[model samples]
Target chain A: MANSKRTLAALVYNRPGVLNRVASLFRRRGFNIESIAVGRTDDPKLSRMTIVVIGDNATVEQVRKQLDKIVDVVKIIDITGDDMVSRELALVRVKATTATRAEIVQMVNIFRGAIIDVGSNTLVIEVTGDEDKIDSLLNLLRSYGIREVARTGRVAMTRGGTIGSIKAEEEAATGRQR
Target chain B: MKLSGARMLCQALINEGVDVIFGFPGGSVLPLYDVLPEFQGLRHILVRHEQGAAHAADGYARATGKVGVCLATSGPGATNLVTGIANAHLDSSPVVAITGQVARAFIGKDAFQEVDITGITLPITKHNYLIMNASDIGSVVKEAFHLARTGRPGPVLLDIPRDVFVEEAEFNYPDKVELTGYKPIHQGHPAQIKRAAELINSSECPVIIAGRGIIISDACEQLRELVEKSQIPVATTLLGMGGFPGTHVLSLGMLGMHGTAYANMAIQNSDLVICLGSRFDDRATGKVSAFAPAAKIVHVDIDAAEIGKNVRVDVPIVGDLKVVLQVLNTLVNSKSRPAWLEQIQKYQREHPLCVSSEEDKLLPQHVISQIYELTGGDATIVTGVGQNQMWCAQHFLYTRPKTLISSGGLGTMGFELPAAIGAKVGCPKETVWCIAGDGGFQMTMQELATAVQDKVAVKIAILNNGYLGMVRQWQELFYDKRYVGTPLWSPDFVKIAEAYGIPACRVKNKKDVSAAITTALSYDGSYLIDFMVEPEENVYPMVPPGASLAELMEHPDARRANASSTFTVSNV
Candidate 1:
């Protein structure tokens, strides 16, 4: 079976050791986690985590079911095959000289990347996009001698109207009646 | 009113309906031990080792469908409970292990006797908690018990700091837990149930593989009803022994590696396999690709992750076994297959499980059969790993649920003595027996002192073969007659039992076996009987590792022909 990348988002209770529980579950099951990002959600008591894993459809389904077994997990959504948008933040430092600086700036502008930091011989570029877009930009800048790179794995959400938007519409109707 | 953390913990346990606890105290648990005496509602049994404490609790839980409790201190003491915890996890036994940690201030400072217990037990435990504050003790205890006992029960651990035990906190136990993520599916899908019923009705040759889940869900009556209604022959996993009455006409005994030859053949020949609550472990399914190859499997389990894990199922119903079996009984129509039953009978007659009475030496099977005859298949039998476990599973008949307690999944060697102690404690009125081999008996025989001191009337039956029989059987079959480290040197079990202040006897002849058991049963306290049987006798009908269930070595003569030159060339 061909392995494909999957993005799963989970809403969990904000408590101590929740992250460890999720991470250890993956480690124990021998599932390699590509990337994981966690942050507090709109609800103060709940936190949302985005995990990028590489496996077949069946393996990913098993992971979702196993995650649902955890007491601290509130909900899990596999947004991989859904109509969704994903973004990854990457900061890359490239060796730039007076001669290559202008060309690098033009390449960054083409990709809509921002120059976050400038040292005497290095320029730190911040890029946010889907994995392919980031990879393309990184590839274009490799000739300038890439010094270092750091990426905040992929975070994703459904593209159009979701459950949150449906709730908002219900609240709006009640507000009009009031 | 304010109460110390230890007192609050004791109160929480009492509130959860806990009456007994198995524990071994250490430096980090001193504060809890000091306050333990005040709680008269809870009785504590001091075990010889932390491992024994854990296994005893596990056995108690298996005997009774309640959460068994065990306590230990930090570091080495907590680490000693690892094997027991893993055993309970694998078997889905409800056990709550409480470990005392270093004081709060010394938690991360590499304090003496401080080990990351929760971290060590992360994979084995269903869930674990580290209590940093005394105020959360009540709710944590409540949650731990609820988690350990509810839907697909498993082991849970709670590590408390020493300072937390001494600190004062207001005790307010929670009335109900609100866990959003841990909802277990109890009701099966109506469509799936209908599909399963259709498959069961249409199939001419059908077999039911009942597993530990039937016992865990307390669905023995539902299972028996379903089997009798459908007229499907039932084969139980090792842990599922008592779920269906072994003496029933349609019962095919245990299935898998060391299972009955007829049972394994019936499964292989069946057109439909209705798996209830039992995950098809590698031991149960000889070779994954060839196991029940022609059968369309209907698997029902509470845990969704277990579905399609090892074997693909045609109709998968994720729900509690009791509810699923209840609904299934109503949906399934009455039917019978005389041809299939006749075929199984033919298999049974062709390769019957029998020992020749003409042999002068006493066989291990005779000992088990004698025990069964003496107890009328009513005693709660607990066994350690290896040949003794397989022999007991084969020869003894279990008529009631929770009657056979053994470490099935983890295969812990030293489980018999401590677990039997726990089993006796759980059901004081019933007769409990620990059937162990010489190798495994020595591993945890130290717990005999605990049994004598506590006055637990658990009969000890040691099948002393002088060698690690199961491994020796393998060596005899596969590794050319060389024994290697399989042979053992041991102390006299009789003297050992006597030293522990327990009555002891030895039975070397077949005729004396019954008298020894009768004498052991007569004693009100613990008693040990060392039954010296033929060391070279092997368990037959073994499906060699990686072999298909269809290919089983039926007897020693059959093995000798296929075995290397070693067995055939050597003296019989």
Candidate 2:
């Protein structure tokens, strides 16, 4: 099978060097991480990571199994083709002059974005949507001399259902560890 | 009761059933040494170097099937243990290494004698931790040992800061580990095992590649039963030497690079390959694509990632080898395969692994065979990597499990002597022999002092070839015999051994091998023998780099005079 884009979600314990362990695993396994976004989940003790990588099924499977080998990683699931909603937030500080200020505001409004900061020389625009929507908004604002852009890589969650690991956790309690 | 972290660490180890610890003290670990006298059950062996301590712990673990413990201070002491730790990790030896870190406040502040040992060993260790609080020491120690000894065993490390050792804390050792992702599969799925049994019953030509997992899992008897019941020819990987009885009728010795010709032949011809607890290393499976082309593989391993990591398999049984094999034994039928056994015997007769006798020259193989004959093939034989290692693997007929211990994966050179010392320390009643190359022996020969000091009565046999023999063989065969930095200069090994207060001898003739080995075997204390064997002698039945198992290069003497021109002899 040909290679395709993959997004994998993992629940991990929030501990020191957990990020380093995950990053080091990918580095040593020769797998490239396209984008990875990690933040605290509903539980304070757990962190959720949505990682986007590109590989075939076998390679992705291998990546998943190897990633699961990390002692800090609680559970992992491939959420690529699943019914999940993913969005990225990007803060673009565009160089807006007197003439281009109104034009940039109009472009942000058209992309369904908001101007969080209005500086004398630049406008800081915060956009949150799918990758394509963010990219399209960035393209229009790029001609206005964007000063800086910082993006939180894709964070995803399945829609309208619970794709959870209650069963795996229960199995672990009974010593069904893999 | 409130106790210091150092005392709690000792208590945790005692609770975990650790008998001995190999370690070296430095500035940061002074508190550990200060509190060591309070621990009555733990016997500490003071090694000459931190590397020796690590290897010794590894050897102890390999011999006893328990977690080996090593201790060292911060900075250089911790760095010195890298090679040995890597050796244990690659070979899946159960070891827990504890290193002292700089004080918690001084950490990341360029403190004196400070280094990130945990970060440095992260890749090599199964798991590692840098505990900031003294309260976490007991729990971390328990966790480290549990991780090191259970489920596809490997080395685990804990780096505790200097302050934590003397700082007082309530020591509450956790009875059970609480890692959600750290569980290992113990029982194989029943359906998968049944399918594997079905594959075994159906296949005509089957080979069992018994690996180190057999010895690690203590399933040698089960493996033998399975092999006999299924009537499959069993071949061992180098590390798997003693896992299957070498003298058994169904045994095809070792298979892979420098493997026995008959074993390699059997593997290439077999229609089914049932791998137990052994990863398909490149050395074992010459060219991955050409490895067992006609065989439908049934791989059984505790780690799930290992099943299809190296080669594709038909039935993948991911679980503990012992549990899997017990169920498999019940399912497999007792059968007879006269034709397959006859074919293997034919290969054995045609290309037997042997050295041609020379009246004057002392052959390494001859020395090894002599040792095997003298010791009754029961000694725990440990070896350094290279030609000496292969010769020991081929010549020593191991009839017991965990009898042959070598650094299989990392191929660490200075592993034998220290590991032998450790094995002797762990199994005091068993006769232990250290087979080292002269070059490798020089790397950590200082550990002979440790052996003498600790009264680890292990006999040392140095195959003094005066060169890194394996690299020389590779250069001769593939690098056009350039011999760049291969030749070695050495001191008088006998004198060196005598300087360390060890009984020593040198052998230059083949006739004296018997007496030398017999003397070493019977001697009460640690002895050393420098066998000046024929240099430039290459290990035979070698699969050259990038070649398939079928393209094996036979030794000049192994190729019979009137045999068909089927074997290729390297022009060395």
Candidate 3:
């Protein structure tokens, strides 16, 4: 259910209860809210939420309508139905010693990820990119030995314009009225 | 102002409220046993084997939520508890197994009757301690109880060397316990509760799945209120049999491999599934890919790891079930969908469980219901694995938690008799019944002496079919009746119970049943009543092993359709 191409951008008042309302909508629908990134979107009074959700076209449309009804949500968008630029961050630690450490570092550089930290026997690498790029890098880094991994999942924005920034400002104006 | 280490151990145990302990003595534990005589109000059952002692403790723990305590001497005495300890560990039973070690001077010197019990049990226990000093005994014992009873409660071990028990010390038993690394978070975030409520309100069709956690957390009342107020139907796991009474309008009996068809259908068709304290076990979900395929799931549990471990949850709230359910109950509006409920009720009526025909010579359901009638649904019913276990669970009417005791997680055979002894001891006022199959009876039948010696006075009802009933039934259904190594020539159980100084009766015809049960229950001493049930009889309404709930097979009995099959079969 989490395997979906639709992306939704939600604007909410900068408060504690907004995330709950959004998550509850997806939970009640049995659809995995794949990736939800919430932060102040260039406005102090409001937060922008980018949600990557998986569902059919009808379900996606239903989710947007449902989110619009929630009190905290100022607006909802179906960005996947439009063009978008998506990026995600991941941190992976691989087992390494002097024996195979150099070979692994070279692979990390090729993936455009940085060697964040190093211990006597472990190397921690941080990478950020689209889902496909992250998957390819993980595949390339599996040879040296992956010990543990944590991913930030996917968060996206509209491409070729400051659409998310404008939407954030517009939602904040109406959020204060309620 | 001085105190002996032995006296300190007794004082610590009293402080921990250990009313009963099961143990066997040897050279190393002799001092502690000697001190036991001086401690008032604490009764210890001297079991034949240390293994039996450990199992008795486990049974006591499982029967009552309290931490069960057991003791043994060094080497063989301590080692005998391995099987029971492993059993307790696998089932997540709270047990504090105390074993003695050789004197401190003899430690690691290959001393006689010395074994590294703590090292041996490390992998099995949640945590273990080796007390080398007499001064530390009281505190360590206190900590052991604390650890065993809190946070996914599991068995803990304490092995003390003999010298520590004999040595003198200035004992100061602490009234309060403080552990740094062992705090379990109970209250969930307010935001999480609000979100869960929001999800429930928005869902068009929502079903609540409750588990043993509701009982463990003492949240059944709140959970019931939530489901009722929200107009949601509730399905429970096997361990959660009586969490919400099966008679409730919203109660959708047990759901799983052998679950009632309606409960499974309720989950499968629901638009949203709200799960409380239930781990989506393979049995509960059948094949995870097809389980509740239509629903979005919101999972609430105390353990974080359990979330998304089985069925992926859209909203995972890590908190106490009782707390979350109470919050949701208050927030959600009460609205019933009669149409949705009607659909489920149709499934319940159409796929009702099938009891064997009245004409059948020996059906287990009849035997169980007869036992229930004789005991008046108030006695504690314990069971061993396979057909007898399922039959007892299905037919027996239980009104209270812990009243129906069986090995749910491990499904261990040979658990009935010894466990019944433990249950009887735990609740001396209640009539305790052990319903076991022939195969499971002999495994720990030697413990019959414990009942006779302890004068527990519990009754043992043996469903003597001369075969491993459950496995044989499975072979009959799926394995083309190959019956490999399942058949056996049974011994005279009546004579065996008689040998232990307990009264015994045998029933080969239907008329002998009532008299046998009457004699067993009325007798002042322990009694064993053996009923030779039909060998070919099987537990019906079975969901074929590894099959989904939708694929449950009803019994071949035609009378079951009318629900008029009186539980009457020959007891002779």
Candidate 4:
């Protein structure tokens, strides 16, 4: 019963208070959410939400079932064990002087990140990758005194399989859809 | 033709076959009330409080299996319905609550009598809507009804601002709703059903824990068929009491805390547990990990979320109860359970469900049984929370669906009076009985006025225990008998009932209980009786908190009389 990171993508009716309904359900049912992100899907009436939570497989399966119970949630796809592509966007600002700026720039280059903002004493770097690469860059900048950071929780889609199909949702709990 | 928002909403209700509603009128909902006279087909009962309106609507829904309707004004009015809505939500009753909000322009400015009712009811409701425009009135009402009655029925709410009620709009009610996300699975997967049948066929000792889903799905006939065909004994949850006939040879009365000893033992010894339509609520499954440890659970429910929420299921089937049972019946092999049934009969004989009778004092069980005997087990019985609720559940033999309507899940006190009123209103030809405890009776006794005003003819029986008996029992058993706030001080219930213009009487002795019940049952209008009973009586065969069903505390009298009974001192 080891806790593992689970990524779930939900297609939901784009309506007022829909996000609140989904989030409130997770909190009320005693499920801890690690991170979550929301954006409009290709369908105008539907929105795609990527949710990251940490729990054992059974508990996460219960989570997927409960989330699917929401009337506004059109579908749920758990890509945790699937062959999937995932990325996270993070904006990190590290405290900097002229002496530390070039070293920070080199670290950003190695991580393939861009300097999004620059202040007299702070350098804001933007990175987009899986959670690990961003964590690596942030860990590297911690010694230079990281000032502010905002991380969009990871969003995921399966590698080549059809997502959101009836078969996919049915097999999510079984962990054999892909 | 164009119609005001109020007219459109009323028309939609009429089109949906709603003939009656329970409500209280106030400032913000004046426009809605103003148009009530035009709709002569609609009848509204004026309730004493918004809470009573909600409970009445719930009672109506449970008794009739239709969507119960309740309406209230803004702020306090809307908040008052919270408990009733939550009660319906937990019990999975179909209810639609309509609340009027402050004028659109006045919202969010701390306007008088304004509150964020939709937000307040969000978690408690299946779904809720806030009517921002007048044109959306018909569809919102349509969708609210659709959601409330379908897909594991629950309470739904529609909060309309005052301006929306008066604004004129062309009204066209939709005949269909297109909710892609809300399709409730009705048919069980064929393979899963076959697997469940194989599990059942392989088991030597099996127990079918029938739940409210059977009644809600109108699958009691199918349940009877399955039980008779499969030769499986049935134990029920509190709300599932009537799903299987209490007098059936296969029936093990309600299981869990305050359940029959035989039922709990049967479950503890079961090899296979087939749960239908009922969620594995904590009350039903004591010490979850230890509950039915030897059994492989096959859970059949309409909601997928309920399958593994409490106990993990081996063969999980999500479908409507009737639809599932119909298909399940054809697959389960016919078997003889002579050994299992004989073993259960031995358990019943050793630990029979009985009440300690007294020649001088009236017990709560005596009052309930007399009502059962007098009504011939044909009344729609409603109960408030606590000891009276348990006694009524135990003493009365419910053989039909929709006959026992009580607040099961939320355990709300004072649900008895208003819900009985609602049940009486919905089924006027049937006898309705409201059995309440003194502590719970005093909570919403004001609804006595509503009962009299509406001429509902509901018979009221108050088990006057002088204290919150259930808490007192717990305190006596677990807290060294230090009676704190459990003792209640209240006025004479007979006088209170008289003030409401209902014929009332008080019964203090066991002999007087029968005549009082007889008088109430035959009375043309509503009647009330306050039966002063033994205050310290406790509901026995209790599965102690966090104790498995195998560990039960038998009756005190039995423990004192029988030296060899399994009464554990650790619970004390």
Q: Indicate the residue-level lDDT of B451 in model 3.
A: 88
| Runs in model 4 lying further than 4 Å from the true structure | A30-32, A95-100, A118-122, A161-163, A166-178, B559-572
The worst-scoring run of ten residues by lDDT in candidate 4 chain B lies at: B563-572
Winner on lDDT between 1 and 2 is 1
Off by over 4 Å in 2: A166-178, B357-359, B561-572
- For model 4 the local lDDT of residue B432 reads 94
Model 3 DockQ, alpha carbons vs. true complex? 0.02
The iRMS of the candidates, in order, is: 5.6, 2.1, 18.9, 5.1
Candidate ranking under DockQ, highest first, comes to 2, 1, 4, 3
lDDT of 1 by residue, B49-123 (tens): 999999999999999889999999999999999999999999999999999999988998989998999989988
Q: Candidate 3: which stretches are off by over 4 Å? A: A1-178, B109-111, B358-360, B558-572
In angstroms, the error of model 4 at B501 is 0.6
lDDT of 3: 0.78
Query: Which model is ahead, 1 or 2, in terms of DockQ?
Result: 2
For residues B270-307, could you state the per-residue lDDT of candidate 2 as single tens digits?
Answer: 99999998999999999999998999999999988887
Error of 2 at B9 (Å): 0.8
- Candidate models: Cα lDDT each: 0.89, 0.88, 0.78, 0.88
Clashes of 1: 0
TM-score of chain B taken alone, every candidate: 0.97, 0.97, 0.93, 0.97
Question: How big is the positional error of residue A168 in model 1, measured in Å on the Cα after superposition?
Answer: 13
* lDDT (10s digit) by residue, model 3, range B91-172: 6678999898999999889999988887677556766778877888788888889878765567888888888889998887
True contacts kept of each: 0.68, 0.75, 0.00, 0.68
Per-residue alpha-carbon lDDT of candidate 4 for residues A48-160, written as tens digits (9 for 90 to 100):
88899988888888878877877788788788998889999999989999999999999999999999899999999999999999999999999999988999988887787
